[model samples]
Target chain A: MAVEDKLKIELGKQGVFVTTVNEIYNWGRKNSVWPLQFGLACCAIEMIATTMARYDLARFGAEVFRPSPRQADLMIISGTITKKMAPQVVRLYNQMAEPRYVIAMGACAISGGPFKQGYNVLKGIDRYIPVDVHIPGCPPRPEALIHAFMTLQAKIDAQPLTGTERPRHLDAAAMSEFPVPTQGAHDLEPPANRLVWPLPAPVASGENCG
Target chain B: MASSPYFSLAILFLAALGFGLAPLGLAVAWAKLVSPAKPNAIKNAIYECGLESKGDAWVQFRSAYYLYAIIFLIFDVEAVFLVPFAVAFTGLGISACVAMLVFVLLLAEGLAWAWAKGVLTWA
Candidate 1:
C-alpha cells in the first residue's frame, strides 16, 4: 500500500488528518504556475520549443503562457536585457500579482550572454528584478528550462508558510518594487544608479566618435 | 415557500450570486491572508517592456477604420437575422420571402455604395 494510503487508514480510526494548509497551498501554487508569454530575444524561440508537443511544458503545469501580467504567476526572462528594455521588464515584473516568480532563462538574461560586452546590454536582469532561478546557456535547451522548473518547484516546496519571515512573495513587508530605468542622452540609466558602467566623458568632442 | 411562482427564481438568483461570489471571495481572502501585500515603489511602477515610457500613450489613428468596423458589424448582424429566415424558409410565407429579399437588396446597395467610394480598397 502507498504510504499516504496507509497513513490515512491508520489516521482514520483516530479521526485525524495530517498536513498543513501551507503545504497544500504551496503545492497548488507550484504546480499551476502560469508564466507570462513575454519573450525577449533568441532564447524566446527555445522557450517556445519547450512548449511544443515533443517537450510539452504542460506536464509540469506551467504551460499556460498568459499575455497579461496580471494573470501570470511567473516571468521567464528569455533573452538579453537591453538597457532600453529593462524598465519595461521591471514594470511587467511589478505588474504581476503577488506570489510571482522569475526564472532568468538563458545566459543572456543571466549575464547578457555573448552580448555582455555590448554597451546597450544590461549585465543581468537580477539587477532590476528579483530572480528566483537562473538557467545559464546562450540559449538553453528546453530540457534546461524543465530542470529549472524542477529547481524552482523545490524552492517553493521548501518555503515556510508560518514563519516570522515568510517567502518574499508571502512576506508583504519584505517585498519592495524595483526602480524603472529611464532613458538618458547616451544610454539608459537606472533610477538609482547607472545600470551600465558610464563611458568616459565624451573625449572633448574633437576626438573621433569611436 | 416552494409553491410560490417566484420562489424558484429567487433561489436561482441566490445560487448564481453564491456561485459567482464564493470563488471570488475565497480567492480574495486567500490572497489577503496567505499572500503578503508588500508594495514598493519599483514593484508598482507601470511596465513598458522594461524601458521607461516616453511621452503620452495616446496616438492618432485614421477614422476610416471605424467606418470599416461599423460596416462589418452591420453585415455580421445581418447574417444572424438571416439564420432564422433560412431555417424557416419552407414555413415562411411569401410575404416573409419578399421582406427578406428587400432586406438583402438594401444591404447589397450599401455594399455597392461602399465599393464605389473605394472603402473596400486597401489603399
Candidate 2:
C-alpha cells in the first residue's frame, strides 16, 4: 500500500477527524458539552430544568454533567458565592483543563442579584473567574438559558483564536508555590438546605450501552 | 424629582469599580506572597499554531479583536436589560411591554448588522 493510503487507514481506525486546531475547537464547542455540577443555590434547580425533557439541554450536548471540575469544560455556577466559597471556586477554575469556560447562571452569581446587599455573598463570580456568559434572573426561564448558550456559541464562533499563552501548560516550578488548595473547605452546605423538588431514584434499565 | 439619579449612578459606578478591582488586587498580592518560579526553555517560549513553537508566542493582538469584543459587550448589556423585562412580563402594562418589544427589536438590529458584516463568522 502507498504511504498516504496507509496513513489514511491508520486515521480511519482511530475514528478521529483530521482537522486544524481551530476546527477541532469549533467542533468541541458545538458538541460534547460536559458541565461541572456546581449547584450552589436556588438557581441550580432551574439549571437542572434546562437538562430535563421540557427544556431538553441534550440538544446542546450538555446532558453529561460531571461532578469533578478537572474533567468538565463548562462550569455552570448556578447560585451565590460566599467569601468562604471564593477560594474553592478559584481552585475549581484552576483545576479545569484549558479552553474551559464559565457560565454565571443567576442573579447571585452575576452581582449577588437579590442578595447584593448581603454581608457574605459575593457581588459577582466575575471578580474571581473570567465569566464567558452571564444568565441573569432570580431564576431564568429555560428558554432564556438556551438563549444564553446560543449567544455564547455565537461569541465562540466569532472568536476562533485563543490568546498567546497556553494557560493549560504552566511552568512546573510556578505550579510548585501555586498553593493550589486541595485540602480544607471553609463553608459547609447548611443541612437545612435540600432539593426543593423530589426527583426520582435511578434504576438499572436493560438497554444497550451505545 | 428631589433625589438625583446621577448621584445614585455615581455611587453604583464606584461600587462596580471596587468589585472589579478587589479580586485582581488579591490575586496580585497572593502571587507576590507566593512568588512562582520563572519559566525556562520551552516554557519561556510562546505557543504557536499547535506546534512545539520555535520562537516566542507573544503575538500582538489585532485591533479587530477589540472591535468585536466591544460588539459583544453591547449584546451582553442587551441581555441584562431583556432579563428584567422578561421576568416582569405579566406585571408590565401593555404599552410598557410594547416599548420593551421595540427595544428588543433595536438590539436585534445590532445583531443583524453584525451578522451582515460577517463579524459573527469564524472564517
Best by DockQ: 1
Residue-level lDDT of model 1, residues A55-92, one tens digit each, is: 99999999999997777879999998887788788788
Candidate 2 accuracy as lDDT = 0.66
lDDT of 2 by residue, A67-116 (tens): 76555778888898875676567666665644567888879998788876
CA error at residue A175 for candidate 1, angstroms:
3.3
Model no. 1, DockQ:
0.36
Winner by TM-score: 1
DockQ of 2: 0.01
lDDT of 2 by residue, B22-120 (tens): 999999998666433333332232431112345555778787887588688778988899899889888889899889888888878887888898888
